[model samples]
Target: MAYPDNLLSRGESVVLSKRPHWKMLVLPIIFFIVIVGGGFTLAAVLRNWEYHTIAWIVIGVLGLLLLIWLVVVPFLRWRTEHFVITNYHVFFRSGILHRREHQIPLGHIQNMETSVSFWGRLLGFGTLIVESAADQPLEFENVASLPKVQSVLNQLIMDDKQAHRGGPQQGGYPTGPTPAQG
Candidate 1:
């Protein structure tokens, strides 16, 4: 999806962009299954005729909390987190109540590497490690559409390099003395 042009400065263009891989939803799915299974197990275990009311209430409350986490938490995370890339930088934003954002400039980027697990490969997703000349490496973990993101980043880097190499426009402009005069 295209972000507003006003979001970045002049000469900036989006290079690589993606969301978290669908695989990330797995944990929440497992949590949901566990909650259901546990609820059933609790029901069976508490089938005794003399069960305490307090114990039953506690089990119900725990199950409700689990249900909220499984159903609501994952959905909120999926909706809130976003990974964005521009010609000059990469941006990561996430969180619901307390928002967080991080930006890494392309000029500082030393190299980028991608890793994919068997399941991730099957699903066409991977993790991207962005190394910088400075301390601390930035990681884009479990990112979907990795190959396309990589390709765009590579192309942007090449373009930036070529632009740098072309060197001092308008035919040098003879700063000291002309060769013809010498």
Candidate 2:
């Protein structure tokens, strides 16, 4: 999904935008398959028994509830979750029903790290932990292409610092008149 540019400062732009890794969909996909398969299996078994009408009704209701919780909810949660890194801020927004958004400015960031477990290394995705001065650390979990994200964030932080300093701009252009003539 495209980010709203109105929220950004004039010169600022998104450096990286991503959703959680496909690994996150593993459990939801499994649950979806199980729910569908179980529904079919229950229907077949009910057909074998002539007096299963009432029992089938009860099972169907329970199955639907389980499907909503295990399959549908997880899918929606996964779809809504987002992690974004812009020149000025790191944004994390997530939730299925009531959403929550957290932002950490690059200037406020005290420390950052990239982490990967054995399984995460195997999957080629990792997490980014960002700690700022005023607030608690924010974890961007299950980030796809984590190394690239880390590199881009570092570059953005440097560029942001340079932008605020106004000493030199891109392509080695000075913000003020050079003293070479004087």
Best by TM-score: 2
Prediction 1 TM-score vs. true: 0.70
> Residue 115 in candidate 1 has what lDDT?
90
Candidate 2 is scored at a TM of 0.86
lDDT of 2 by residue, 1-182 (tens): 56667777888788888889998888978987887788779878887687788777877898889989987888788789988899789998898779899988888888998889999898889988899999877788899988888888888887777777764665477666679955
lDDT of 1: 0.77
| Alpha-carbon RMSD to native, per candidate | 6.4, 3.1
After superposing candidate 1 on the true structure, give the runs of residues whose Cα lies further than 4 Å from its correct spot.
1-7, 10-16, 37-57, 166-182
- TM-score (all chains, Cα) for each model: 0.70, 0.86
The clash count of every prediction, one per candidate, is: 0, 0
C-alpha RMSD of candidate 2:
3.1
Whole-model Cα lDDT of every candidate shown, in order: 0.77, 0.84
